[model samples]
Target: MYKFLLFLTASALPGVAAAQSADSDPAEAALAEIVERQDAARQPVELPDGRATQPVTLDAATITVTATGLGTTIQSTGQAVVVIDRKEIEQVQGADITRVLQRTPGLSLSRNGGAGSFTGVNLRGANAEQLLVLVDGVRVADPASPSGGFDFGNLLTGTVGKLDLLRGSNSTIWGSDAIGGVLDIATCGGSGVQGSFEYGARDTRFAQAAGGLETGALALGLTGSWFATDGFSAAANGTEPDGFEQFALGGSVFADVTDQLEVFAHANWSEGTLDIDGFAAPSFTLGDTAETQDTRRLWGDVGFAYYGNDLTLRAAYSMADTERDNFDPAAGSAPTFASDGHSERVQLRGEYRVLGGLSVAFGGEREWTAYSTSFNAREETGISGAYVQLGWVMGRLAAHIGSRIDDHDIFGTKTSFGADVSYGLGSDWRVRASVGEGFKAPTLFQLLSDFGNPRLRPEESTSFDIGIEQGQRGRGTHLALTAFRRDSADLIAFVSCFGATGGLCTDRPFGTYANTASARAQGIEAEAGIAVAEGFRLSAVYSLIDAEDRISGNELARRPRHSATLFADYEAAFGLRLGADLRLVSDSFDNAANSIRLDNYAVFDLRAAMPVSDVFEVFGRVENLFAENYQTAAGYASPGRGAFIGVRAAM
Candidate 1:
């Protein structure tokens, strides 16, 4: 059945390719996500409330705050960063986070089933556990999880205003769990009100509302969203259906105590319930047994800032908590498994301009983490870290150097260093390169769970990347290419305890975590965007990766060797817009041993919007237009063709 769908989509490709003229090069439109703004000055624009708004020109070099916690444009920084703003997010209309993140060149995602299911994100071939995820500068990872990673499935794009995806390692700035990279998400905040409602296939429903207000030195923002779906069976061979329901709320407040000082606080809450199909234990076969999961998460932060003409100081306290419960009726159990994780953090940061064209930024942080499960004893750990970075910019050249030390109660200490340089080759061209080190501490569960090993060591990594970019704004053309490599060591993996080594105890028949894995990943990414015509634009991206486990001589699980995407949009009369996207992914193995193979596939989507007035608009989209059946995980089915329509209003 899937083969027929694949052939149908492949057959339609020739017509689209033939429509493009040789003179039309869609490089500028395609590379818009990565190209830096090209401004030559740092100016401050004041708002109506006498507050200064950071200056950001559309054509100016892309400025980044996640790389160094200091504002620096991509044209001047050596790190590879991709920025996704609210405008793009609105156009995509993604219900969840994974849909948006998978469009990036070097990022890949795997899901066990449909929306709200367990999802994993891999950046540049790195495991989900190796990356760090931050929401408004606060870490939201689950300390009780075996991998200590955040679940993308639970996050919605409706509340996000900006997303910064930084590729390559830079633990020197973000501390541990940055062996891959960083995903910094900034929630929506501003004076305005917007609301949306949608209905889609399979009894899917969505609704969202957001608003903000500012008066004098005080500002407040609030947002909420709800989603529900009658989803398909989670297992491939199952006939029963599963469903999901979720809700989220977020708010923030800020006040200026004095001219140079300000205070701020924010809180976020999300809860969800998911119905699932379970497999018969021991046989590993899908059955009619019913299972379900209930999840609740909360995050809060309070902070103060002192902004000076050439110096800035800030401090913040943050906390995050996550609780999950699983129930299985077939086992006649009230709750088969239940776990809770919490983390608390305090940080101080200072940045100063000590010399002309030279500035220094330094900070220190302390964190406490705890985990508890129904079947295991509660455990806790502490971590302390400090970092310093120096930045120098002169004419067309920019350079940055930084280092950090992280001390963990169980793993002792680990140090990392990183540096990057960017040079403007000419008015239309720029080149940049970066080299960095990264590390990850063992999660509390890995050290205290029943299958844990207390003596586990931290994983380490080294990575580097180089790239070149060229853009002709007047001609509406842009191009970018990047190559990167990463080597990791001492990766923690479960090992059988039956064969004891080095006089280690072997009381448990299962396995324990051990530092026994090493791997290397290399990839190339190319992006281009061009205006095909006055009313039409096209963008395309291609990525290639070679990731493997060195000791086992096996390819990394679920990391595709080839992937590409083509996007086209057209503006018509009467405030009408049309867009289409096609994505292609090659076959990949789903397990560590490279035994389970998933087939290659292509999926296409179509969307359209029409504005009835300045404040009202209607939009619709068709996903999996050809009903291409594919899977990112073995024994899991992808969504078939689905249609959705929605309306949005703003005041």
Candidate 2:
């Protein structure tokens, strides 16, 4: 049967490709009793799960998902994906998405040193660049910039309303960068008045204010935030200091021209400075020290959506202008790098509830990325693609199948396919499984980089996942467990000690980027949330990864062995919320050679807030409570235990 589906989806030829459920469970006991009765009869009874036949609710679904490129709620989709809302973002006091991901299970990172400059994100076994980053559904990659890839430094936990982390292969829906997975950022439109202030140890501080005010057809919102830190010391004598500071501002607006047509836009800008450090701090001399290099990014996107009785037409235009300059006075001739990117995509997808429990939809996208670098020649990419997906439903059975064909101008053409199936075992419980093929084309920087190589080939992957989800009726408590495995081919890796002229790294000069042998990654993720009691709740997230090479006998660069995160909070009757958390990362290597080792460490944090009055509230947090020295970057140490305090005022 699975083979039939594969052949069918694959044959859809040059053809193609292709959440969260928002359902309530009632009297799980009744469902279990039925199961028991069937088991006693020594037969596979038809069972009784009324939910298997209910219609999906539109508003109560999960919008961002991995299995299908389309936006839909969790309960309605057939995949293993999760959404991290703003409330949960605070429940963890997480400064970066990486910190939040460690607790997410099945996902991990390879931190450069700190969130200072070059950082990357890895999903499954794919390289950091393979995991795509999107803001308001617009692509944010330079293709021409080195880390034009996804850099966690841009992580603004405070500026986002929610985060959608989709596991497995997403090439079918998102195009190239979707190989390993996709990280979708959804910004809040600021409705009504809102704000928050948090301060902690090591001179760390953060403040944000946002609100949405609507006066008829026009809805507008403004949000801005500031972040800074004194940092920690990795090696006692390391010359560079362990600290940093940043300032950011942004806003969004939306208007409804009619009951069926709406337009929206968002923008953000940030700048900061940080101390430099050497590999073996305290014992080694600082290399290429920079007091701070200032950077600013401006992202703007405008889109129009028309929702009809059965069809939707959506179009968006986006532009990203990222500029960076080194403030260090000594690094002579160090060219300032800048990236300008633009994308325009129009999607025509329509869905209809077929006669029975079956629904079908099809759509296509033409995406163009024009990237220019201040230090090198420009590179361009044009990808035209179309896909169709079908969702079949019946009592106790449902399946989703999808396929996509992308035509790339320079990287060669490619195709992707995927399918997912799920059946509710009974109240509060469901089992799911999925299989798919994914890919990542060469980035502009990888192909036309200063040390760029033109012979680079696209990276590819095969993946599978099995998961279980459970939630209590109406209480908002939920638990999920998912196990995943991925195999990557023609994996891309940075080789050191290349060509003659100087380069980013001596070995990387003439080395140029090339598809390495292969890699394998397997892991499990688990999460839980429960209202400990009314007004108080706790959430826990954890992930484990075992990633490695196919023949080199080396572990992939930057992928960690284990990670765990814990969050707890208490909400007071006065509308105040207090929270605490613990974060941990296991040991791992920084390079492919696996010589440089990063030690394992766990850090704790505490935060509290009080609704002082009707228009004011005060909050603060102490990070790294134990002062346990750790390095997000290989040689540099992160900030030690520190405290920050602040206030929020709104009308």
Index of the highest-lDDT prediction: 1
For candidate 2, write residues 1-651 as lDDT tens digits: 322332232222220000001211111111222222222333122446322243332321244444454444455455667676555565555366665665555566654345454557777656777788877666776544663476676666766665777778767677677767887776654345555555565556565555557677776766556666666543344544456556666676667788767777777766666554533345456453444555566676777765544444556667666665544445455543445544555555444444454656566777666566666666776778777778765555668888888887777778888888877776757787888778887766777766666677778888889888886212378788888998889877676554455644454555677676798888887888888887877777777788898878798766777877777788888677888888877888877789988788888988887766665656677778898976655655565666777565544
Candidate maximizing TM-score: 1
Write model 1 residue lDDT over 363-428, tens digit each, in one string: 999999999998887899999999999987665667999999999999899999999998766545
* Model 1 residue 326 lDDT score: 94
The all-Cα superposition gives candidate 2 an RMSD in Å to the true structure of 11.4
lDDT of 1 at 575: 69
Q: How many collisions per candidate?
A: 20, 48
Local distance difference test, candidate 1: 0.78
lDDT of 1 at 361: 82
